[model samples]
Target chain A: MAEVRVAVPPTARKGEVIEIKTLVSHPMDNGFLLDYGGRMIPRWIINRFEVEYNGEMVFSADWHVSISTNPYLIFYTVATETGQLDFKWYDDNGEIYTHTAEITVT
Target chain B: MTQKSTRRDVLKLAGAATAATVAPTIATAQSAGGVVVIGAGFGGATAARYLRRAGVSVTLVEQNSSFSTCPFSNTVLGGINNFSSITHGFGGLRREGVNVVRGRVNAVDPDAKSITLDGGDTIAYDRLIMSPGIDFKWDAIEGYDEAAAELMPHAWKAGSQTNILRRQLEAMPDGGVVAIAPPGNPFRCPPGPYERASLIAHYLKTEKPRSKVLILDAKDSFSKQGLFQAGWAELYGDLIEWVPFSEGGNVARVDPATNTIFTDFDEHKVDVANIIPPQRSNRLVDTAGLADGGDWCPINQTTFESTIHANIHVLGDASIAGRMPKSGFSANSQAKVCAAAVAALLAGNDPASPSFINTCYSLVAPDYGISVAAIYRIIEDGTIAPVAGAGGVSPSDAPASTRALEADYARGWYASITADMFG
Candidate 1:
C-alpha cells in the first residue's frame, strides 16, 4: 500500500484556471539496485497517474523508472462546476493508490 | 522540466558575469561592536552563530537564502537522498539573534572597516570574517567556460549544478560513457570527485547497468585512495575506470559542442561530462587583496586573521591552513577558532590557543562508507600541523557491518553538523 496526497483549491471562480498538486509515497525501486545482501531489488514504481474532475478524466501521465521516490505532480485545469477530484496512481505490482478532494466553483 | 531550465539559466548567468550584479537595494546600518560575516555556508554561518553566542552583535550576509551542502550531495547524485533533504534555511540563525541578510557582497574596504553589498549598501564592522568558498579557474581548461558548463556541468557548488548533472545522468542511455574530470590537488573536498564517481557508479549500476563511469584525473593520487579503490572494486567491479595524470589523464581541453574531452594523449567523446576545473579562493579574495598575490588567503594559524590585512579574517576553503584539507568539516572547525579569536579581539582580550578537528566521510555506496579524520593545532612555526597519531583513515579490511555502521554515522554526521551551523 502507498500513501497519496492531493491539493485542490477549496473554492475557485467560474471559468478560472486552478492548480492541482499531488505527491505519492513510493520507493520507486527501479530493479537495478542491490540490497544489503548484494541481491537485486526487483523493479517497483508507479507507472501511470490520472486525475478525474467531477467524474471526467482531466489529465494523466505515463511515468517511467526515472521518476524519483515520492513522486510529485502539479497541473492546471479550468474550474467550471467542480465537485470532487480523484487522483489515482498505478504501480508496477498492480497496486493503485488513490486520493480524493472536494472543491467548490462559483 | 521548468526547474531544470531555471537552474540551467541561473548557472548560465553566473558563468556569464564575472561578478554577478543583483538588483540594488537600500543599505542597512551596522552599529558599533558589530561583526559582519560574509557567506552563510558552513564557515560563515558557524562563525556568525558563535559570535552571537559570545555576546557579539553579528550580521551574516549571503547571496542565497538557503544553503545546499557539498557533503552528502553525492547521495543526491546516487539517488539515495533528495535535493530538499540536504537543503537548509537560516531560520535557526535568526532565532539565535544573528541578523541574516540576503545579498551578495560586492566589495570589502579594509581601511574603512566596512563591506559593500551588491546594491551599494555598506555595513561597517569592527571585524570582518569571510568564508566565500571557491571559484573555478575557467582559463585553466581551454574551451571550458561558463557556457560550456551549461553543457558539461561541474555540479561542484552543490545546488543547481548538482541537479543538472543528475538529470543528464538520468537522461543518458544505458551503456553510455560518463566522464568525470577531477582537478589537481588542493581543491575543495579532496575526496569529493571520487565520492561523486562512486555514487554515480551506484546510480548507473542499478539504473543503467551497461553504462560505465570514467574518471580522467589531473592528480595521480587522492585522499582515501586505498579505501575508495577497495570499495569500488568490491561493489562496482570494473564499472568504474580511473585514468591518472601520469597516464595522460589530465584534461587539456573539452569540446562541449561534441560532448568530448581531450587529454594529452586521448580524446573521449563521452555521453555526459562533468569537468571540475582547477579552483582558487573566491574572486572576492583576489579583489580585496587578501590572497596576497597568491591563489589562497594566507591567515594567521592561531586566529585565522589574514596576515596581509588588519581586523579581517578568512576561514574555510578560501584560507591557506596548513595540513587541513578543504572540507565542510574543516571550515566549520576553522569558523569556531576564528569566531573565538574575533570575539576576544572585540573584547580587547588576547585570543586563546585553538585546536581544530576535521572528519570527512565519503559514501561509496548506500551501505558502504569511508572517512579520513585528523586533529590539528598551531605548531611553533605559527602554522597548523596535524597532531600525529590523533586521527587515521578507515581500515581497508573492514567488514560489511562496519561499513554499514560508518554509513549510518555519515548520515548522522550530516544532520548534526548542518544543525550546528544553521542554528
Candidate 2:
C-alpha cells in the first residue's frame, strides 16, 4: 500500500471548470534494472488511472513503465452536479487503489 | 527572483555594454591587457569563458593539460563509469578566445598585479580570479601524508587518486573490510564521503557480497541522511554501517603500513583504507596571501571580490560562500556571478545584484538517486542566504520510480553540466 495525496475544491459554481491534482507513491520499477546479484528486477508499476464524477467517467489515462514513480496528475472537468469524484489507480499486479473526494455544486 | 533571471539580466547588461568597451576593451583597460584566471577547474573555467563571451580578453592558467571533475567520479569507483569518461580537455574554452596557458603559477604579486610562471614568465592582469579548489591538511591525521596517500588513498580529488581507490577495491578479496575515514565539516562536497561509501557498497554487493563497508565519520549527521540510510537498508541491507563521531568514529591516527585506522577508543585493521583528511584552500591561495591567515578566502557575496585584497576574486571550494556548500554546482554558479561582477567592474558599472543556485545529486545505487537543491540571494547583511522554502532535499518517502527518475536525471545532469563546463 502507498500513500496518496489529492487536492480538490470543496465547492464550485455549476458548469464552472474545476481543477483536481493528485499524487501517489509507487516504485513503477521498470524491468530493465539489474540487482546486486546481476539479475533483472521485475517490473511492477501502476499502469492505469481513471477518474469518475457523479458515477460518470470523466477522465482516464493509461500509464506505462515510462511514467514516473509517485505518479502525479492534474486535470480539469466541468462541475455538473453536487456529488463525489472517484479516483482509481490500477496497478500491473491486478490491484486497484482508490480514493474519493466530495464536491458541492450549486 | 531566481538566479537564472539574475544571470540573464547580467548578460543583457554585459551585451549592451560590449560595443562601448569593444575598442578599448579589457586589454587597453590595463597595461597587462586582460583578466587572468588561475586554475581551470569549474570556477576558473566558467569565469574565463563568461568574461570572454562579454568580449573581455581572458587568460586561463592551469597546471594540468586536462582536468578530471570530482563530480561523478564515484560512479567510476562503483565500476559503472570509466575514468576517461570524466576527464575533459580545454579545447572548447580555448576555441572561445580564452588564452589557455598550461603551466604552474609559481607566485602571485598582488601589489604589482602580476603572476609568475614556473618558467619565469610573468602575466599581468587587470583583475585575478583564483579558484584553486582545496588542499588537504597533511598534519591533521597522523601518518597520512602524501607518501601514505599512494597506499591509503583519499580519492577525494579524482584523477589518479580515484583510479587508485578503484583498483584497490577490485584487487581486494571477498569478505574484505573497507574502512573510510571522512573529515570534519567545511570540507569540499559535504555529502561526498557518504556517497563514496554507498557506491563502494554497491560494488561490493555486486561482486563480493561477503565484503562490507565501514564509514568512520567525523560528523554525527550527514547530508540527506534519512534518504541515504533508507536507500542503503532497502538495497544493500547490512552491508553498509555508518559510525558517527560520537561513537569513536573520529580517526586520530592512520598506520598505512599495517592498513589500520586508530580512534580514541578503538582501532580497525581494514583491507582497504581511505583517509580523507581535513582541508583548506589550495597552497596557491596561501602563497598569494589571499587567505589572510584563514583556511578559506572570504569574499563579498555580491561581487565575489576578495575581502582582504582588491581586484582579486575567489570562488569554488576555496571560497567562504555563505550558506553554500562547497560542491561543483556551487562553484559553477559562483563562477558565473563572479564573472558578471568582474565584467561590470571592468566596465565601471555596479554589478547586477547577484544570486546563486546549487543542486547536488547522489546515487545510492545504479537505479536509485537522491538530491538536494537550493536557490540563494544576498540578504541585507551582505551574505548569501537560501530563499525560504525555495529548495530542499528529495522527499524521504518518494517511490522507487521517483528515485529511478532522479537517477536518470543525475546522468543527464552529468552530461549537461560537463558539457556546460567544457564547452
Candidate 3:
C-alpha cells in the first residue's frame, strides 16, 4: 500500500451514473527484474482492486504483472445514496489498503 | 443454376451495384483528404493513433526514428539504467495504421495546404497538426550552435547526443567539474534540467565523493525548487553549487573545441557541459508561416486550431499555450482535448469547450519526489487559465512520509500519462 487518490464529483443526482477515478500508488512489482545482487526479487504485487459504495461493491479489477507500477483505475458507478465510497486494494499476500471518499447526492 | 431470381441474389446484386458506384467516389475523396503531422513524439503519436482510429488517414513526418527520451535519460547517465530500457518502437504506430515517414519537413504552405519534405516531396493535406516539440535558438547564446553541441551536449532531443553526454560524465575524472547550464523560460520541462542535476549530484556524492556538480540556471526560481533544495541539502550538501541568472550564471557563449562557456563577467571552463538551450516550435512550423513570434505557434486555446492557418490544429510544446509549461504531461493533456475537437468537427458536431490538466513530477532522489499539478480551462476569450485552487505544489517543508509518497505519485504520474498517450 502506498498512496491513494480518489476523485468523486462534489454533487450528483440520485440514481444517475457518475464517473469516479481512483489511482493507487504501489510498486506492483512482478518480481521480474534482477536486483543489484543479480538475484530476482520475489513477486509481491497487488492482484485485485475493488471500489465499494456503502459496503456494496461497485467496481472491481484483477491486475497482472503487465500493469505498470502504480495502477490508476477510472470507472463509472450509479449514485443512489449520499454516502461514502470506499476503495480497497488487496495484495497477493493479503495486504489490504483502504481509502474512503464522501460523496453527496441531490 | 438459378432459373428464377431469388430475393437474396437480387439484394446482393443491388448492394454490389450501390457499393461499386459509391466506393470509388468515397475512395477518391479519402485519398484527397490528406493530413500532415509535424513531429513524431508522444503528442503526434497519440493524435496519429486517434485519427487513424477515426478512419482519417495521416502522414506523420518525423526528423528521426528511434527518438531518445529525456524522461529517463538521467538513469542512463547515473549508470543505473540503460538506453534500451527507455527506447520505444514506432511499430505501435504502424500497427495503428498510420503512415510514419522519416524525413525533415522544409516548409509549410497553410494557404495551399502543402508541406515540402526535405527530399522535395510535396505533401498536400486537408488538415495539418503540428506537434514538433521544440528547437533551440542558437542566437540566445553567442557561441552555441550545432557545431558547439559536439562537445557541449544539450541532449535535449534524447538520442546519440544524450548518450554522448552521459558517457562524457562517466568518463570524467573523479574531481573534475561538471557544469549544467539550464535555459530561461518557455523551454521544455521546467523542472527537468534541475532534476537531472540532482540525479547527477546524487551519483557524484555516492561514486565520486571528490567531484562537484554546478547548475547555472537562467531563472531565479524553479519548479519544486524548495523540495529539490531540501533534498540536496540533506543528501549532497556542499557537493552541488547552484547559481541563478542574476548571480552571473547566465551563459553567453561556448567554445566547445576548447570546452569553455563564457558568461557575463566570468568564464567557467569545465570537463563536461550540459547546455539546455532556449527552445521554440520545431522548424516546420516556422516554414509553414504558422509561427507568430518567439518560436511558438499561436492557436485558439479553445479548439487548438491555428489562428494563422485554416483547418490546422496545433498542440503540445509547439503551441503557445499561454501559462502552460512545455512538458510531456501537458502535451498529452492537450492532445486529448484536440482529439475530442477533431472527432467532433469530423462528425459534423460542434466542438466542445476543452479543458486541460497537468501534473509534473520530478525525482529529487531514488525515493524522494516532488510535484506541481494544475487544472486549466479555456476562457471565453480564447485563453487558457488555471482553475483557482484546483492544484498546487507539494508543501515546501513536507515530512519524510510525504516525500516518500511523492515518489510513488511520480511513478503513478508516469503510468497515467503513458496510458493516456500510448496504451
List TM-scores for all candidates, in order: 0.74, 0.76, 0.72
**Local accuracy of candidate 2 as per-residue lDDT tens digits, B1-423:** 344567778888878776666645565445446799999988998898888877788999999999998989999999999999999999999898899999999888889889999989999988999999999999998888999999999999988999999999999999999998889998999988888889999999999999999999877789999999999999999999898765557787889899999764468999999999999999888766788898999998888899988998999999999989999999999999998888778877889998899999999998998999999999878899999988999999899999999999999988888877778
Query: Which pairs clash inside model 1?
Result: A32-B206, B175-B211
- What tens digits encode model 3's per-residue C-alpha lDDT throughout B297-352? 89888778899888889999889887888888788788777766765565456778
Better of 1 and 2 by TM-score: 2
Docking level for model 2? incorrect
Q: Which stretches of candidate 1 lie over 4 Å from their true place?
A: A1-106, B1-31
Give the lDDT of residue B212 in candidate 2: 94
Q: Could you tell me the lDDT of residue B107 within candidate 2? A: 89
The residue-by-residue lDDT of candidate 1 on A1-106, one tens digit each, is: 9877566778999999987767666888988999999999999999999888898999999998898776766689989896988888998999788888888899
Which interface RMSD values do the candidates have, in the order shown? 20.4, 18.3, 18.4
True contacts kept of 3: 0.00
